[model samples]
Target: MSVRRWWWVAALGLAVTGCRTTGSAARDGQGTPPKQELQFDPVTVTADLELDKLNDEELFAGGTSAFAANDFKQAARYFGRLADFHPDSRHRRAALYNAGLSHQRLKEWEEAEHRFSELADPEKGQGDALDAAFRVAESRYHLERYDEAVKLLGTIAAREDLPVNRRLEAQVQQGVCQLEAGRGEEAEKTLRKSLATYEALADKDEVDDYFPAQAHFFVGEIYRLHYEGVKLDPAKGSDKLAEDLNYKAELLLSAQGHYLRSIRVGNGYWATAAGAQIGALYENLYEHMVNSPAPAELNAEEAQVYRQELRKKIRVLITKSINIYERTLETAERIGSQSAFVDRTRASLEKMKALLLADAEGEPAPDPAAADGEPHS
Candidate 1:
């Protein structure tokens, strides 16, 4: 699906409640146990009345109205008051959830965290409490407290009472937090676990492949970062240089594998991104191989052979990169995707072609058949 359509679906899904069932469930957790409801935007307040006279429900309605109108500050005020003043009211839990959501929309990270923390209380409602905790963890993530976010998500994911989907989400989110915290290795492990779980869920028809698609995309990102970190030395001796190049090749191929899996999962947006990244991976490889200096100790014949091999390698890399970009562009067009990623990929394809042509037009290497009686492949 196009991203715009996906976003629209998300917005509509958030505007309604009672579409899913949630009930009191106890688990071996310190606080409220997780529920199976798909609570996205919580319940919105829709009361449009004087604050002094408004009852709890009315106050909640007012908050909902404010939120729907994009007046997040007013929405937060109404929901916060309903949650605090009418603590025992039936609407209190929803009010608190909405308030936290409103505060998040306003970028009031601290207030959002506080509101979500309140609903996470086991003394209140355990049904949606896990959802609240999830929101709290997300708020911490927005605040750049990645360690705290990871910790909270981990706690949520550990609860047996939580639905499998929620647990998987928490696991993925925890990985994201770890990645943001510069814990790449930990993130990779976490994400890979989530990926496996997602595949299991997909196989059971418990969840869509979209979740695994997301996991694969993030895994690709982790490896892409690893590939980018591989440094090549132009001045190093041939042996060391070859070792580094081999290591770089391994990283690049690993990244390629992850990206290919992401694309194969068939999530339009992520697939598009992964396809584009595949192009970029090969482009980087080509540049690295091309710019790396040959060892100075080699005789003229050896140097010619080395240059010929390098050119052959560059041709393969650039051609593959261009092909991937073309595939990405076609996929985007096929999906009616309207993302900047598609535009960038198209531009990259043109640039890659130009680079390939430039390499092809460069000074010719000696024919191996003429020089050494060996046929060129």
Candidate 2:
């Protein structure tokens, strides 16, 4: 469930950078010729070595070195020089891609997108344009251009020669873009296919096998949104209540099932999130029950019996909810998750505890939000 928001950070864990100190600029007779103000975006490259001695390959090496060191501005400058000045250089296409990557690392999405667009062009781009297409989609996704992201991802997914892993990643990203764009049914269809591909993989334990859990989590979110739209009215007779409750139960259970599947497939942050959400799901149902009015047709005795039954159900539901919250806490702790989510789960657990105690004491629980000084949802 570690959904990748962008490809910029993807290389951070895979490659460790070496230390490289920025060299002090040497003063010249004209004082560095009064820094040139260029018409295009600024791309300044500096080095301790003589500029004249550095060839395109050396410039590219400097860019990649700076990239490894996380100096995105410096990296972009070096790569940009190769892309802008060395048009005939064999490294031009790669330089463009690296420039895009450097800008991406700096969170300069527009600049990154521009560079990536050049690489995405079949006629002009060289070497692995398909991968460049994926990066272009990633840039668009981060910029909240969900429609563009989906279209680009579709192109990558449709390629016959693309690796299955890359294709699946593209499909998953396409589904994510759909979901973000509020196209739930389309998201579900695409994500379901991605999930099936993950499940069908011969090596389920592959390091890159992340889409299955993410797909499950997103599908559960779709169900959760739909469930929130359902309203149950207690003014309706018990028969009506029974029918409506059954329907609500189906929606909630569907969400719960997918959440559990996410947890089962991957015991990562997404699983913890799904676990926390399951607790919230049950608590929401309990709240609905507590807030509901008695049926108008019930006799006094029948109303009393119904009230008792309601209280029992509420307590049972909340208790189940509390247990799931506790499970989330335990899982987070077990995984040494120091994420803010772990703190939120802890706060939610405390709130659930108060809720359970409130029912036992026959008094309203202190506002769970007040107890934690943090909003639950």
Candidate 3:
């Protein structure tokens, strides 16, 4: 559920950059077109001609220029004009695609979906229709229309004509869509199948493994979140608590297996994410045990004994978590990577070190009310 809430933050946690083709007139959509001025329709067009005065080709060129300059708002408007107002223009398909991509860059999901859906329409689509269809799924995912995204992704994944990587991406996105839809079990099965497909691919090494890496990391999250749901009842005493903890541990190790799989691929971002989550698993366990309700059967003197002894046993969790955070941070540095996960690992590492130091110094637990920013009573 935690993953579902923010999984769309980076296109399944990928700060991925894709290719952009500006137009025939411009240099690869980089800076301003140095040589190509807008050749307006046989009139004395001024240097700063308005959008209304520009011809369709000129609009296309302007959109490309705007897109290259990271002015996606202008790019969307110009490209939308080329696609909508100039139906007869030769650059119509390119214009629509550019418009959709521009909208996506701006996080305008509905507008992006509309543009892509038009190009992906059976009657309207051309050679790039498959790509447009994929973008439509992405737009739908961003819009939180997980069911629609899953359906569209299924169709994309089933296509034999597309590249293996494209199909794999579709399948992976489909699984994630299912997860976002609150279908965890189905999502895990779909993700496992996707991983199997990736493993079976002969050209797997030649292509990007981002999707598969995500598959591993998300499966780990699935288990981790499930583990978070396991509750303890102190009334059940130590033996029953041990059983509950065992189940929780099994879920964590299951998650840990997937996290290990994610790191094994060496895709820098996903690996960092998995590593951070792995540390959090132990940290969470420590917190959970320490914060559980005290056993009702214990006398006041016995309760103090229980708390101290419990802290002594669970202290290893902090140590283990600290080790993982340190290692993960080192791995992120070695890979020359930066992400929220790396920041989290660094912070968690510091926090755990503080906890370990506090315990070592025999500092009393801070009062609960004073945990707020107010001075202790």
Candidate 4:
């Protein structure tokens, strides 16, 4: 069978034996509703293929045991059977939850998405629905359905019922999705909001120290990615886009500052990663600035001023990039030697510096006497 078809068949099998098999019966209406009670049947499907003596708790325990043993496929099977056969059992919802988690562990993305999506349906199982929603969004993200993931995460972000950390995580994921979808402006905005929220929560001692830095790192990545994309684009006409590009560049600068601050406050992989990203952004901006054409409207004085400012920015960025490269190289050397990737990056940085230096020398000066003799406007 085709991959998609096989995926669907597996998903169908899981659904038939999982949450989708639950009965649609409502309790009878009375003056007062009947006291809710969990129901279970004792019939175990054993290795001999005989349903002999299994209780709901036993079945659930078996599934949990399988999960703990890293037999996610077996765990899913057991959990699916329980969910399918014991619809009214208290373990039914939990069974479905376990099934979803197991599928996720198995990397059965479509199957996991189906189960999580079902659990997240408001009209269906209300047990940990918010968690399910988040997982569904995560699954979609992994599947590269970035727009769908963003939409789902956006909803989660807007909900007040979610915990601060969960809400912040959703917001960050939404920003990630937006970035993947090429909505850089939206991603930057969302990531900024997430970072601010994380910071506020951290200040109140509501969250761990790591979350805030993670938020900042993601925000930094958004700006860095945005700058890279704009710098790569060949078209140059709109003042608005140029302004946006400049704004993104400034954001990267600010992000680099934040990354350094994070390192000062707390040492972690995030700070190191952020430092590398900042270096890459600087290289990208340096290359763009070096290649940028001179504006037509500038007089000699205006041109000189513009060139001076540009040179200052480029020089600062180039120096920063070189510093970061040295640090990365040291880390790589300690880690057992540089990879081809790092070698290529180092070469690129060197080329970028050469270009920047060439650009910094400015245009060749016409002979002052000849120009003065001939030029009177």
What TM-score, computed on C-alpha atoms, does each candidate reach? 0.71, 0.70, 0.79, 0.56
Better of 2 and 3 by lDDT: 3
RMSD of 2: 11.2
Model 4, clash count?
A: 1
Question: Can you write out model 3's per-residue Cα lDDT over 138-212, one digit (the tens) per residue?
Answer: 899888999998988888777777667877888888999999999999899999998998888777875487988
Among all windows of 10 consecutive residues in model 1, the one with the lowest summed lDDT is 3-12
Tell me, by lDDT, which candidate is best.
3
lDDT of 1 by residue, 1-377 (tens): 21111000001112334346675775556877865566555576443344657787887777777767777767766776677678689877777777777677677788888878876732223556866788788899999999999987888767677667777878888998999999999999999998877766545456565667777888888988988888888577778878888888888778778878888778899889888888888888888888877787777898889988888877777777777788888999999987888988999999988987776678553343333221111
Q: Please, what are the lDDT tens digits per residue for candidate 2 over residues 270-369?
A: 8788888888898899888899988889999999999988887777777777778888888888887666766777887788788788777994543443
Which candidate number maximizes TM-score? 3
lDDT of 4 by residue, 321-343 (tens): 76676665555555454355466
> What stretches of model 2 exceed 4 Å from their correct place?
1-82, 85-95, 102-107, 121-128, 205-207, 235-238, 295-305, 338-340, 363-377
RMSD of 1: 16.7
Backbone N/Cα/C clashes per model: 7, 0, 0, 1
Which of candidates 2 and 3 reaches a greater TM-score? 3
Stretch of 10 with least lDDT, candidate 2: 2-11
- Judged by lDDT against the true structure, how good is candidate 4? 0.63
Global lDDT scores for all candidate models:
0.74, 0.74, 0.77, 0.63
